[model samples]
Target: MHYAFDADQETFRRELATFAQKVLAPHYQPDDRAGRMRPELPREMASMGLTGLRVPERFGGQEADAVTTGLAAEEVSRADINACYILLVAALNADILVGNASEEQLARWLPPIADGSALSALVLTEPEHGSDAANLSLRAQPDGAGWRLTGEKTSISMGMLADTGIVFARTGGSGARGVSAFYVDLHDDRISRTALDDHGGRAIGRASLHFDSVPVGRDELIGQEGAGFVSVMQGFDYSRAVIGLMCVGIAEAALDDALDYARTREAFGGPIGRNQGVAFPLVEQATRLAGARHICYEALWRKDQGLDHTVAANMAKWFAPKTAGEVVHQALLTFGHAGWGSDSPQGQRLRDVMAFEIADGTAQVAKLVVARHLLGRKFAP
Candidate 1:
């Protein structure tokens, strides 16, 4: 049971952190204020080989393992939480393309995705259904050897400006087995998007995507008909673990800020950190963050090893964001009055961490996944 990153992984982490500090940190404030990514950011990420970490190297991706991917996500989050969305969405879409796309399709999409010439999103959640994904009501009907889709997907990361996306829709019967995935171009006139006023991760632009009879060619279909749900759910097992790492990274950043305050800020006579009261909460949060980080990497390691890590993945997802929120809150309080100001990024960091509590899967939904695995599906809520 190794607990540390390999020499290679650690080297990569340092490199990515340096890259993020130089590229992502400078734009964080302006992008957050604008509620969308800077136009040049994606191209920058691609030039650095940061966009398609999971795609095969032959197609220009790093072909990274789960652990490497998690490391990259953590380093990126530490710079700007919103920028991490670019990596996460790209990973999800890459999983779909790698597992189900035709060789020709892979050749066409992988390079642009790897190079950041194309921005992408994984579109699954709709206005009516989120965790209950099996029952999504998006309709994908037959149209002369192709498909025409019409539905509304809300709160989608990068929806307001993605160049492409992998959209899930119902094609056969009802429930999970009926779902199919398609690669769709976001520029189509039939597709319209509206940005949502979200509390955090504003630069990512959570938006509602309206597909009005959007045409999808037969070549765009991913995997066999009625098999899309299986592919996507499998991909989640990989992503949920990485999400845990991303949350931990943001919390760690907040902790770093608090530590600086504790050591330098004066109270009574000496630094406030000299007192137990100001330092204990930070200590507790630090401990929790360490544990969460270990769990996140453990799950990711299992993924790289091709082990069945379902329980570990769910446990990481269920606990990491919840802990991150608590830890960031403690950091905010430690900052005293300074943290409350809109000028300080602490408040924004807290809001951004809160989004993860509901993003991939809510804490309760993650618990249900774990329960169903351990106690059997019949006994799960």
Candidate 2:
């Protein structure tokens, strides 16, 4: 029943928070405005072994547990929300590769990511299949000695910049059983990436990938064929928890900023924070943020202990992002006219938090998962 973080975890959190504030924060505004990923951030994260926190030590990683990774994600994201995006992608890719990739594939892929020489992005969502990933129309056909994959994946984070992608395509027939996962190199002539614009989390560089008969060897298969859906779901289970942490970070930052402004900005010759109208909303926001944070950490802890946490993870993923959006919206309102300006960081925070509401899974989809788990399929129509 211990609720507090251990000394080592606390130390890790403090170190990450310090690094994020001192280094990452300064780069967030300019890089996000330009829709560019920070060139040095990935290398810096690699230097600290943050990119490979969940990877095996044999693969040149620290082999840290999931809770530590979640803590690091929260700290970095508190300074700059986009930092969470990078960290989560790395963690998710590492977890998936470690759990499913063959020994030779791991040898080829894991070290570069650990050393920051390579970046990996998960390519599951397509233009046509957002939540219906099991029925993705992307086809990967047997071609001579290997496979030729042709499909278009849209709204993928780090899609343009990633050295490799773990893509799910249909190799069999229809539905979940037919899906298979493949690790494809983006450098192939048949693969093309086009950067997408006009979105929140602009610093992360989402894109659309067009694969035209891209060649992949048999070793690229992750897990067994027809087992791809299960692998992808497992990846989501890991990733959504981190995404919940990201929401908590962003909400905390926004609320802190708004509170600071409320305490300082004079209204009617007194601080606006003195008024119950302004103060109560702030209090409510803080309460919601705290609740969401607890849920996120509990889910992470359950995951680290290898407990069945699908329900808790889904709950956090559903509630945290929506709560964050509401908190940021309230924060923006507290800033008045200043919040509406594009020049203000609050507006950017709002847009960034909004994306999370739909990122890993929509609030509705998450609730569906929770409902199904709680009620069971035989409950009712």
Candidate 3:
């Protein structure tokens, strides 16, 4: 029945909001201009425990719940949406590691991430297989007791900067069952990276990762071979909610800026806030953002409660980013000429938010998931 953050949660939210504005926001534009990730960004995030939101405390992590993880992502994203990709990918990988990794494996793998010595990327999408990830063509040839992965993964978030990644590859026959996941060392000389000339989210270091016979020890195999795709898919459901909140945060930031401008900027005789045409659209955007944000939080809440949240998460995945794109574009228009310039973060926000509509899961793919959930697997697409 309660519809607000508890006292501790509110405090945490405020702390993160301050940290983000003071530490992260300043670099948001600078990093974009440089077209690269700031080396210090991950270290600063780790100091705040943003990098370890889902990791176990015993392993030097905060061990935060899904709702809190989503909350952290939202607050951090308000200052820098591209930076939130680090949070999203790390959280998703952490959950996977926590659920499927053995104690020894956890000991070996997690502390570095918690302490921010290592950055993680999800090596799932391929040049030929994006949404069709089940049919990924990456080859994992058995070599001695381990495997050697060889293929290309394109449009990977943080691919260029990550010291390690969970690389999915085919180990058996064709289709999803043949696939296996490995938490491999990405820093190996066998792997070559090519950074994408991105239009948006430039700081995320999206790139194409080419694995050239990179060796993976048997110990690095995540869970059982052929079980990788299913495990990753399950972890991804919760991350969709996190991605939704990320969209909400950026759009909310844009709307606040536009509102401030509307109140202060004089037009004709007085403030533009006087005009219904200008005021109403902002009103509608705010309302839409609120609704989308609520669904996102609700999905994460369901996750924390151990309830099936696929439907809500998928819905949030589809709606929030799409709503954010519309909202940011509208907010940009509200800024008049000021929003059009390179100096304006509004345009950057628009481009960054557009990536969400395609990354993780595309809007169309998310709709299909919700459709299956609502219409029954037998009836749905």
Candidate 4:
């Protein structure tokens, strides 16, 4: 397997990094402090053909593969983790809708998504079901000519701001096989949203959605009925890789900031970095960051090549976010009081990376996936 990126991918990465540095990094601090979404950023991303990285060129996307998408995500996230979150949701939503939506549905949804005129949110996790998404309790009952949905979804990223939502609800009897995916317009009269007052990741605008008998037509069904759970799971198989890469980017940023501070910050007649206590943790951060990057890249590579990467993806998802959290914490500690200051970049980095541990999938859930894969059904509970 080729471990190195091709020239085109490298060029794409460099361009993305340059764009982030110029456009995102400068505004991230101010926008985040105000808890505001960068409205102009999405338009810029679409103009650069980033919103639809994985969608077919016919659908106005670049049609890049998994590895390219992961690389782009890493660079975008390194600049502003919140933007990366938005990009991932857009890319993953496009991937799912394009892969599963009917021709008419695609005609209706894909162009808007590709052009960045609209944003989509994945509503899989319910108020009760998170990692256990298959156990969804949201009910979608058959109505006169369509269906009516009633449920509450919590912690939905971009939910408050999205124009459309890919919602999963139960249509059949019970269990995962009964669940169906529907593309519901968020503007419907029966739907309402409340933004969560979260401590971290506030820039991404996580929210709870309340759907009270929201009407949906047959065209809203993505793929087949009872296949929503599997479709979402398949989507996660790739999205989690992107999430892992995001963690890597956050950690890389933290490490870079810490190393820069170490070189300039003086203590005991010299830079504190001269002392092993401060230097050693930085060393460990570098080592872990390298490992997480390798795992994430390898997982993405395997995906692009059509290889089975459930195990590698889960391992990366589990390890990368946890490693990023550790590295960011270490970076904060390296700065001492400066890191604790609200105005400090390291302080913001710490909060941003903390969200990675929970987004997409929590660290605990990722470990369980890895354990289940390695041990089969014999794995302990």
Model 2 misplacement above 4 A: 378-381
lDDT of 4: 0.85
- Which whole-number lDDT from 0 to 100 does residue 150 have in model 1? 94
- Which candidate comes out best when scored by lDDT? 3
Q: In model 1, which regions exceed 4 Å deviation?
A: none
Instruction: TM-score each candidate.
Output: 0.98, 0.97, 0.98, 0.97
Residue 296 lDDT in model 3?
98
Order of models, best TM-score first: 3, 1, 4, 2
TM value for model 4: 0.97
- The runs of at least 3 residues in candidate 4 whose Cα sits more than 4 Å from the true structure, single-residue gaps closed, are none
Per residue, candidate 1 scores C-alpha lDDT tens digits across 1-381 of: 556888988998998899899988888777888777888888877776778798899898999898999999899998888888888888878987898888899998888899998999889999999999899999998999999999999889888889999899999899999999998889999999988998898988788999999999888898899999999988888889889989999999999999999999998999999999989999999999999998898998988888998888889998999999999999999989998997777888888989998998889988999999999989996
Candidate 3 lDDT over residue span 1-381, tens digit each: 888887878899999999999999999899999888888888899999988999999999999988889889899999999888888888999999999989999999999988888999999999999998999999999999999999999998988889989889999999999999999989899999998898899888689999899989889999999988998899889999999999999998999999999999999999998999999999999999999999999999999889999999999999999999999999999999999998999999998999998998899999989989888888664
> Against the true structure, what is every candidate's RMSD?
1.1, 1.5, 0.9, 1.3
Instruction: Report RMSD for candidate 1.
Output: 1.1
lDDT of each: 0.89, 0.85, 0.92, 0.85
Instruction: Mark the 10 consecutive residues where model 4 has the least summed lDDT.
Output: 372-381
lDDT at 302, model 3: 92
